[model samples]
Target: MILDRQLLLSNAQPITATAVSTNTIDLAIARDIGIGDNLELFIKVIAAFAGGTSVQFAFITSANADLSSATVIVQTPAIPTASLVAGSEWLRVQVPALSQAAAMQRYIGVSYTVVGTFTGGTVTAGLALDREGTAYYPSGLNSGGF
Candidate 1:
């Protein structure tokens, strides 16, 4: 899958505590998003989350850049710390069509809610146009001729 840097909400962002994404997609300028096609959000665990009982991921929209008055458009159930391993694809969801139904906020981003203290964790999140499911390929022939 191809991820656009401009559409990225977070790039290996740390999750030591509950916080909003480092970056946000500005829907006001990128007016083409969530119009005729569905926009997908991808969240990957770059580092194993530790010292946290659980964590919930939320897709939020806000009128302010700092997400002072944010609203959750969608969210995932509280995930146990054991499941938050490195290289895990925590979430991949289609962004709702807010523009079609009603007035929409200008900024959209990701937020992490931790139930306990998180000493370590890192995540990478972004917007993607498409994503292929997880698959493994056979290793290339080694030493021996095919």
Candidate 2:
């Protein structure tokens, strides 16, 4: 999957606490982004997470660039820390289609809410043209290709 830098929401951002994404996609600036083709948001664990009971990832949109008072379009269930291994794909979902996107606000971004203490974790999130995510299997099980 090709990731465009301009569509990036978070780039290897460390998550020690609850926080908004480092960047946002301004729909006014990139009006054509999700118009013609479907785009997917990819959130990957760049570093092993430790000390957090669970974490939830939210996809939000708002009129302000700061993302305050935003509407959450979609979100992940609280993911247990035990499952947050490095290189894991936390969330991958398609961006809204043109009709839906048009009715929303102008800014899009991600939010990380950690339940309990989050001592260590790094994540990278962005919009991509393809899913291209890895499929993990239990030990001793191999599907020729994923």
Candidate 3:
């Protein structure tokens, strides 16, 4: 079951360059994300390739918006060299399980890298969380059940 889904990208801009790239937009997750819920990131790629062109997507998360400290949730393999044919591709990342005792606001998003040259290379991505059937609940004040 899927819940709490939102678009992570700020716009539909196609990145067409022969270099490693990063998106200026950063996705924000509120501290209220339900504990133990599974978080996932999805990327949709549309590209028209030429001259050995290729693209890849990576999902990264940081505890701070500045991303001074960041970790990769999904390590994507570089796309295969293109045959110069337009096509669509998909990539995704599933965040590791989270514990109620270790919850915090998270910053999550994706970055794409292009090799050689390409045109009409665009990417769209989003984030979703699936509620878990069971979760840990820390003990609370027990004064009422004497």
Scored by TM-score, the top model is 2
Please state every model's RMSD to the true fold in angstroms: 3.7, 4.2, 12.6
CA-RMSD of model 2: 4.2
Over the stretch 74-116, how does candidate 1's per-residue lDDT look in tens digits?
8899999999999888778877775643545888899998999
- Encode model 2's per-residue lDDT on 1-146: one tens digit a residue: 88788889999999989988999988777356656777998899999899989989999899999999988989999999999999999779987763565557888899999999888999999899877857787999867786
Q: Backbone clashes in each candidate structure, one number apiece?
A: 0, 0, 0
- Report residue 121 deviation for candidate 1 (angstroms): 0.8
Clashing pairs in 3: none
lDDT of 3: 0.52
- lDDT scores in order: 0.84, 0.87, 0.52
* Stretches of model 3 off by over 4 angstroms after superposition: 1-7, 18-35, 46-52, 63-70, 81-87, 98-106, 130-146
- Give the clashing residue pairs of candidate 2, or none: none
Worst 10 residues of 1 by lDDT: 95-104
TM-score against native, each model: 0.84, 0.85, 0.55
Writing each residue's lDDT as its tens digit, candidate 3 over 23-131 gives: 3223243455445655665555545545545666666566666544556656667776553234454565565554322432365556666776654655556555642
Model 2 residue 41 lDDT?
Answer: 87
